[model samples]
Target: MTIVFISDDAQALACGADAVAAAFEKAGCTVERVSSWGMFWLEPLVEIGGLGYGPVRVEDVEGILTRHAELVSASTPHPSSSATIEAWTLERQSPTVKQVQGDDLCVGSLEHHPFIARQQRHSFARAGKTRPLSLVDYTATGGWTGLDRARSMAPADVVAEVTASGLRGRGGAGFPAGIKWKTVLEAKGTTKYIVCNADEGDSATFADRMMMEGDPFHLLEGMAIAAHAVGAGEGYVYVRSEYPHAIAKLNAAIALAAEKLAPFRVEVRVGAGAYVCGEETSLLNSIEGKRAEVRAKPPLPALEGLFGCPTVVNNVLTLAAIPHIMAEGGASRYAELGMGRSKGTMPIQLAGNIKHGGLFETAFGITLNELIHDIGGGTASGRPVKAVQVGGPLGAYIHPDQFDLPFDYEAYSVADALIGHGGITVFDDSADMGAMARFAFEFCAAESCGKCTPCRIGSTRGVELIDRILGSGKTAPDSVEALPQMHNARKAGRSRDEEFQLLEDLCETMQFGSLCALGGFTPYPVRSALKHWPEDFGQAGSAQ
Candidate 1:
């Protein structure tokens, strides 16, 4: 039997997948490197005789190989009951094996596993099963059906179907995907463009990376659908430089799907490592080989973008979701699943100090507590769950007390937070909220494009103010003259009041005066940190 290994998972590679594969082959086994099951902790995971095992070392493989069948079903089970585990028992449930075709390990179906069991994986159903860029495997798994559906329909029908699906941009910006599509369709340019923002710069985000590697066809088909809907003949997937594996897969997949893509051509462009480049305008500028700066809005991309013409700029998740919407009769299939207007499934990426860190695709409205405690199994540190940072680096730091909030656009907005790109990073009780707030500004300062003063200057100043506040517990600073009076009524401290209040003022200026979200959203984590953990900001005995 062939031994299967994850070929593209970054963590798996880091964990010595190549060495394991080489050892397996040297020992006279047919080694097959495959896609990941979205379980980061389990790689370089190995599947031998239909059973999966991971975090296994190259040396560990020798003993397992020596005892092949005996070790298959006898390996100790991981504590996690998630489906991604290899030591599963068929005695528990019906088996749904997608790969590693053997009868030894006895693990039941891939779908029945705990991590994947509850997920509604409309877009990513075929990720781990199929080889990347295998056109035959992609087509066999229901891949180009959406583009075929779009091919038969009129452009207006495609737009209408997407509009009715209630699909919003899966990027940090929660704009309606159909509205943007409709705008592009109606724009007065005969030559329009489609840009898929694959520059995933957020911390703890890998949905785009995995999708690009495992299911590149799905993204290409989605782009083709968008091109057909808006009457565009050219497209681009702007992948970041960090993801060289994704870039290669996307380019190869594009080549494989060339015949199906037709007159609507799709190309992969690499982006420089600027967090701000994930912003649409900066992305457009980078694509055109210009300085990656944020452009002012109003003559929007739908009207003028990607070489000063009508263009559609969408994130990888938003575009990748298009294929499913088209294949499932357009709207009702996906629209009915989510909470409120946040339609469709979110490929939530769990990272940082989490025990069961991986991708979980669920509809909107799942509580933070459920996601962190149940799915994530709390902190990897096994300590108290202190905080969860939702969205990206620019998102708010949520406290355990606020775990009651649901994962929806409107719900997060009500809490002055957002579900940006659906990245949730867990932090244990040992985490310092004060430092997190400082880093948010420091990150913005380092990544800012310098197009606007509020972001470029305010971020640097914001860091200084935080440092001053955290450094001392004395009287108020001169810049924040009003703080002493306002704070005196509530446990009065002058220096504490001055620095925090100064930080607050600086955040306000950045929020309103900044051009793009780089500046506009830097305040979210800072403000939320201060609001949730007042004591952390150099104050003594502040209550939660």
Candidate 2:
């Protein structure tokens, strides 16, 4: 009997992977639903024997199986001869096996695929490999070892190992994970909490969702280890409502691992899809059944969080890395991978108008030039690459001229950019930087929790100013013509230039005056766009 592995990931499901799996099952193939390979473009990906075929449809399944059968007959030690699917997978990795590309479909081993081959996967090591809920598969591939090792050591030693790993929070803030863990562990509180911030509201970021759906047990193991280290008896995973699939998977994983994660009970809390809830304080507020708004920070969440007690709030990726850090000798190996300060691998999500878009996990020193042109395969439209947003919507718009910049936090900070959530949204040459700037402000206005004045008021004003500057304002063109007296008086006025200055001033106020990063970082995109493409703002191309 032929063995088939089909992705049951949400993306795959949306693209008709279920039907394809059903088709294989009907055809007498033993179908195993597994996690996505992260090669999203090839969603609904199906593995027959050891070769991969994707974007496969129910209609195409019969033809694909026939072709595979023909190939197996010609090749020695055929898939049918192999004892099991795992053995078949390992055998097909031989150099003698070659990828076959047809006009109808592309057949190949994912291991040698350019994108998969180039990546140095750590967090996503089991991405395409494991049956997500299968504890046997999890253990076979080195899961729960971190928790076992963590359980063996003193709680303080676990914190020390994480600190030594040099792992920073992947959740845009870039705070040291070990430091946060240490503070939570050392805080004077009998009852501590572990909160996983799964509210991934940023545009073009799905790594968190993917992790939760694909390898939930790993996340659970990590959280359980953190619970052991911090003496926390309870935990919560705060996920956004947009990801029902992830939430479902997590709840299922928690229920399944009840015995393994004794004493540290985790509950899944759903957010109302507020982007502000992605903030640590706001996430805590949401978890506490309060309005999801940013909280003032004198009492940091580590010291006073989650029902006014000590809490460890970590991002999905941050907590997921804990297991890796706790594994024997994993910290030293992980620390040795990246460039200065930024140690360990980063699961950079390549998104937007790019070819071969997916999760590319590698060390921190990879340049944008390499990522965009080499790894990403450039713009999907085949147009000239223009600006690439390195972070999220609030991240600065980096021009292609700066493509040589390394994927490091400090380097991005120096360049007035941020490695926010490791989301790189590529844009082609046709993109309007000024319009993009306006959208940034508009996004802030729509998402602000309304606790702060600058973000709430400044963003509304920013939209109006940008519209006038871009010649889209209501009275912009006809103000001089419609009113003769006003036109005469304002003839000597540098109205456009003044508007630019006012916009800059508003950005400055929002940057400093806002209570949180929601307002503080909104200016990053606006300023970067103005600096790189001044012509878009009705001025010559001069750096501001």
Question: Largest lDDT belongs to which candidate?
Answer: 2
Model 1, 1-544: lDDT tens digits are: 4444446566568778888888777777666556677877766767553455666677877765654445333442322233332322232232323332333323333445567777888777775666676676677778899999998999999999999999999998889999999999999978999999999999989999999988889999999999999999999999999998889888888888888999889989998788889999999999999889999998899999999989999999998899999985657889998899899899999999999898898998899888888888888889999888999899999988899998899999989998999999999989899899999999999999999999999999888778777874334445454566656443434455565567778888999999999899999999888888877886765422
Where does candidate 1 stray beyond 4 Å?
Answer: 3-5, 65-68, 71-109, 472-494, 541-544
Q: Scored by Cα lDDT, where does model 2 land?
A: 0.87
- Model 1 scores worst on lDDT over the 10 consecutive residues at 85-94
Distance from true location, Cα of 331 in model 1, Å? 2.4
What is the C-alpha local distance difference test score of each model? 0.82, 0.87
TM-score per model over all chains: 0.89, 0.94
Error of 1 at 385 (Å): 1.0
Query: For model 2, how does the per-residue alpha-carbon lDDT over 1-544 read when each residue is reduced to its tens digit?
Result: 8778888788889899989999999999888888888888788888765578878988988988888777656663466544443564575575544554333465576767778888888888888777888887887788889999999999999999999999999999899998999999999989999999999988878899889999999999989998998899999999999999999999999999988999789999999979999999999999989988899996999999999999999999988887888888999999998999999999999899998788899999999999989988999899998899988988999998999999999999999999989888999999999899999999999999999999999999899888888887753345554476664544433477677788889989999999998999999999999999898787975635
